[model samples]
Target: METMHKGSAGLVSAPSLREQARKVIRGLVITGQMQPDQLYSVPRLAAELGVSATPVREALLDLEREGLLEAERNRGFRVVSLSLNELNDIFAVRLLLEVPSVGDIAQGGLSDRQLDELHQLAEATRQTADTGNLIAFLDTDLKFHVQLIATLGNQYLAKLVETLRDRVRLQGFASGESPRDFLKQSANEHFKLLDYIAKQDRSGAEATIRRHLERSRGVWGSRHNTTQAAKASVLDESS
Candidate 1:
């Protein structure tokens, strides 16, 4: 029997198939459809998606490289479980890097052209959110941050932040809040950060980054905990 799936019809090429499979599996993880600690084999995912196992296997290996999944030898992949404390630790490392970097940028100051570019990125971030293009908005947001860090003229530092940001991107999708609301909040924070940068306020910029990181951690961490608790309660009741 051919397993029918919505994603099976859109394949233009093998690479596209792999990319699509990756996105679908990532969405499953973000939405909690795929539970942590459960092994998901390539064949099972391929059957579910109505696609060949090759693309699904490649996608799982890609995700495993991203730290979101752990491959068991001779077995399948498992989504890595993250706790609130672990989330906090990620934010702490971000703060340690981002705060000083932004502060340095502020003290050094941005040229008018650079400032305008930041302003445009901030506007794009907000508009993308308003228009409900969450993924595009995230990409824009990342560009803005990467540019901000790059202003310090340290390639290694900027690259480190970029890598860390990629690792935490999944958190943006797992907030459990309404998409528009969460996106709007994120856009507002970007604008505020830009405001401090425009004024060349070192202390203000550092403080804003700290507050933003903490608030983001709190919002997503809280929602994640609530969701887990609700799931646990349901299982307990059933048991």
Candidate 2:
């Protein structure tokens, strides 16, 4: 009986640790702290996270299932790199899903309490962006969007959108703009969305979300260009 009780406790606590490891590692991946194409061993990551290898390994498997990482035989996991075409495809699907859904939400309208909660989340994203807290901004921004979509009560849609968002690489800010400014501008769009929803303006909400998604593509694309340019310059110097 005691053995069974201990086993039950292990089942509960194991998942808790695994989830904690998953969130931290996911944040690192999304925020570009974990570079693409690099093999990350479970032991090293577990030591860095101060957890046992079991939970870290489990967390890594979860990320692999999410398409953020790929398992390598006899090695570890590698962050998956998305091509520009893949990035564009993701945004395209997001537009088709999110724009219409947000419009529906705006027409349906949110309760005052829900709006208040959303506003708080929006403010959190803005604060993180303004302060150049990339990790925090990503976390808050994700929460804001996910919470907004949750109002529609479509669990699958919400989860799909979240997965798509996670797959995009935010390695750097757009060229010719300060990181803080670029992030702040994007963060402020959350408020515009909320305002439109509050007024039950379906068209306004749709436009705002569409523009927001397009702007994100532009931001990430510009950074991709900059990275390529830098690589070219390095090769030129070496050659």
lDDT of each structure?
0.75, 0.80
> What tens digits encode model 2's per-residue C-alpha lDDT throughout 33-121?
56663678887787677678998899899999998899898688877877678878888899999999999999999999999999999
Q: What is the lDDT, from 0 to 100, of the residue 35 in candidate 1?
A: 57
What local lDDT does model 2 show for residue 188?
90
Q: For this target, which candidate reaches the highest TM-score against the unseen true structure?
A: 2
Q: After superposition, which runs of candidate 2 have C-alpha atoms over 4 Å from their true positions?
A: 1-15, 170-178, 231-239
Considering only N, C-alpha and C atoms within 3 Å, which residue pairs clash in candidate 1? none
Off by over 4 Å in 1: 1-11, 14-38, 43-56, 169-177
Clashes of each: 0, 0
TM-score of each: 0.77, 0.86
Lowest-scoring 10 consecutive residues by lDDT in candidate 2?
1-10
